[model samples]
Each structure stands twice: as structure tokens, then as C-alpha cells.
Target: MQDGTTVRDVMHRAFLGVSESDTLGDAAELMLAEGADCLVVVRGGEPVGCLSPRDALGAILDGADPGETTVDEVMAPPAPTVPADSRIAAAEERLVAEGSSRLVVTRDGEAVGILTERDVLAAGTTHPSAGAEHAVRGSAADVGAAEEAAVDAESADAPTAEATQSICEVCGTLTAELSPSNGQMLCPDCQEV
Candidate 1:
């Protein structure tokens, strides 16, 4: 994609998809063969959830039989989605606002490619100031204000504790601040690696 490329332009077209009904063994096999850390969970050709390596590991550690356990039992809800035609800046904002490293891409109500923060970063690095040149779309530009409001809203509103705290995908370290590295959420220590 050029400097002004759309989300569709830079997204990962390879969607390693698995259904919720698939057995963990089958999912693991596909994941291993594909060298994937996660797979898109789909149903009836619609994006439904995500099957992450963490999910499968947790299930196995909890004594769930891989051959018998369904992907539904371990998959996570699908990440936030954005239209393929959306701006790269907006997609980046969504990734941060949603506190996720990845997002599902949609085109005309159909699940298409996957987008990651790294993709955005790569695009930004190509053109210095690209990050500044592009403003976050819509209300996403108000993340700072929203976060401030959420502080007061926490007691009277829904809990944002889970949203603030993140578990490092590599070492399972739980902390609030994390950055994506090599497709994994890394803590300060792991980031060095």
C-alpha cells in the first residue's frame, strides 16, 4: 500500500480460520502446520471468535482433552472489527482503544483479512509523520478524555479493570502496560527479546 493506503491495503490476507465446533486437536494441528499463534474463529462464514494459543494451552492445562474439547470452549470473542475501506489511522486508534493488538477485517459483512498494530507501525515508519498526519477517526480521537471519564465512571459504571490490565502473551506476566512485539504482547523484560 502507498502512504494513503486503506485498511484493506495492508491487512493480512491469510485468514487461518477454524470453526467453534472444531476439535482442539484439529485446531492445534492446523495451527502447528501453519505456524500460527492464533486462528480466526468463524461460523457460517461469519467471524465469531478467535482461537488463540493461550486458549488451547489453558484448556489443556485444565485437563480438557484436546480431541474431545471443542474450540468453542476455549476461543475468545472476536476482536473489534473495522471496515476494509476505513482509514489506517482509524484502525490504529481502534486497536489501542480496544486494548488489543489485532483486529478482524470485514468487507461487505464478510470476514476478510486480519489487521495488527505492527501493520500500522510498519506503514507509519515508511513515512515519518504519517502517524501525526493522520488523525484518529470519529470519537476515537477522544480516547484521553474518555479514559479520564471512565475513572469517575468506574464506580458507578461497568468495571474497566479487565480492560486496563493485560497479560503478556509470552511469559504470562500480568500488567497494565504492554506493547506488541513479534505478534506477542510483551512486558518490559520480554520486549528486550
Candidate 2:
């Protein structure tokens, strides 16, 4: 890889897609079959939204029947995308700005791949500049002190827990607003009616 690598250099090319009309169950099955965490929701060959494992689980938590709920009803709005040739740093910047975990990589306006935070982390592990940039920004001690202060401030004003937090089995989204049913911990959206 070059010193100035682009998103295409590290993006996962085996991206998956699903029809917007498809059911949540269908989307989940597709993810399982493809071994993917998300699927692009398309309508007439154009991307309209993104159906992540979290969305699927959230729907189930909200008590929507997966088989009856359509993908369009639960999918997040179209994911932010970057051109295939965009620098990886640029993609990372976009991700940070949007507070997103991944970005859709496009080529000629067509979805071509996906770049996730994990991918960026892996890339950083092998690139010396990544660590240098962080060092230049702040010393490790400085960061630790800042984190400790933030935690201390938060704890000083912390409120008692009102509900238990749990991870959804189906989609892996952690939620505090949950319901327990039939020994299953579900988010409010996934709880059965």
C-alpha cells in the first residue's frame, strides 16, 4: 500500500444489498447468509437506506413482527458515502464528523464497498503515521487525565439506574430500554406485542 492509501485499498468489496420491500426477516437471513453486519436497501437499483443488524434488532425490540415489518420501515437513511478514490484519512474524518461506524464506498455513484472503524483500526496498526498523529495531538498522560476528569464529573452528577441494560441476541445492539419476555432480553422495539 502507498503512504497515501485510498478507501478502495482497504474497503471490503463484498458488500451486500436488499430490496427495500423485503421483510426484516429476509434482511436478517441475508446478513447471516452473507456474513455481513449490514445491507444496503435498494429501490430500482438505487440505494435508499441501510439495514444494519442493529436496526433489525431494534425493530424486534419495538415489538414489530420481523416477518411483517418491511426493511424500508426500519432501515436507517442512506449511509454517508465516500468516493472510492478518496483518501482513507478523508473517510476517517467523515466518519468522525458523523459519529458513524462505517462509510459506504462508491464508484461512479454505485456502491462498491464498505469501510468500517475496524478496518481503519487495522490499517492504523500497520501505519506509523497513525500513531504519530495521535502523539502530536496530545500526550498519553494528557488524554488519561482528561478521561479521568470527565468520568469524575459524570459520576458526581450521576443518577441511579432506572432500567437494566442488555444486548439483543438477534442484532447485538446494547439497550437500556428493554423488556424481558420468555427469558429473552429485548429492546422496546423488539418486544412482542
Quick one: best lDDT, which candidate? 1
Task: Provide the TM-score for each candidate, comma-separated.
Answer: 0.67, 0.61
Score residue 73 of candidate 1 by CA lDDT.
90
Tens-digit per-residue lDDT, 82-143, candidate 2: 89899877876776566566788888778888887556644542223212222111333443
Error of 1 at 119 (Å): 0.8
Please give the CA lDDT of all the candidate structures: 0.73, 0.69
What TM-score does model 1 achieve against the real structure? 0.67
Cα lDDT tens digits for candidate 1, 64-166: 9999999999998987899999888788777767867788999876789998866765554221231222222123234334334444445344454444544
* lDDT at residue 103 of model 2 (Cα atoms): 84
